[model samples]
Target: MFSTGSDDVGVRKAFFGSLVFETVEKTNGATSITTGIDNPVPIVILFVVLTIVFTMMQIIYRGLKQRRDELLKMSGS
Candidate 1:
């Protein structure tokens, strides 16, 4: 005979199985959440490349400014 409350062992077993099923459902939901997560590597690479390019550009600009300053000082500007 089966009873439908926690006082009965069978009901406790059923409730445990339901909890396990719910956990599997949540795991599958997480899998779908990451479906598009794999494509961002290229975007990350592009961001890093742009950062390096901008850093180099800033260094070049500073170097040109220093050279212009020296040239002005030599020409009495």
Candidate 2:
């Protein structure tokens, strides 16, 4: 507990021209443990990609089905 540079319960300037304050104080400690959902960006991106892929797949499937029906009708006629 070596006190240095005018640490007698008041503000003082150090060698590098920095202000230092020393005081006696007390207060009730306030600590908390917080819980939250983390890394949400990747999950959201994954869902978005899945949605886009499924939508495109459905569009392609419907187009192919329509093309097949058209060909079938032409062949029958």
Candidate 3:
């Protein structure tokens, strides 16, 4: 196992990299695990995407709650 990036939530998205391994004697005792893409760009992009989604959800919830509370208050009045 190999990792190339910080272990933090903020940057963990960039950790969306790859993993590589070899069976040692598979196709002929040769190399087997060779991959790339271990950066922070993907991680950051994912973080932003999630943040947007959560933010929108929170906004919608807040608006619905506010409307419900207002309706209840009006009915009480």
lDDT of each: 0.51, 0.57, 0.58
In the range 45-75, model 1's lDDT, one tens digit per residue, is 7789999999999999999999999999999
lDDT of 3 by residue, 25-72 (tens): 245554333344556577678889999999999999999999999999
Please give, for residues 1-77, the per-residue lDDT of candidate 2 as tens digits. Answer: 22333534333333333333334323544322223333456557778999999999999999999999999999999
lDDT accuracy of residue 31 in candidate 2? 27
State the lDDT at 76 in candidate 3.
100
Q: Which stretches of candidate 2 lie over 4 Å from their true place?
A: 1-36
Model 1 TM-score, 2 decimals: 0.50
RMSD of each: 16.3, 17.4, 10.8
Instruction: Write out the backbone clash pairs for model 2.
Output: none
Q: What lDDT score is found at residue 32 in candidate 3?
A: 39
TM-score for each model = 0.50, 0.53, 0.53
Alpha-carbon shift of residue 67 in model 1 (angstroms): 0.3
Global fold similarity of model 3 (TM-score) = 0.53
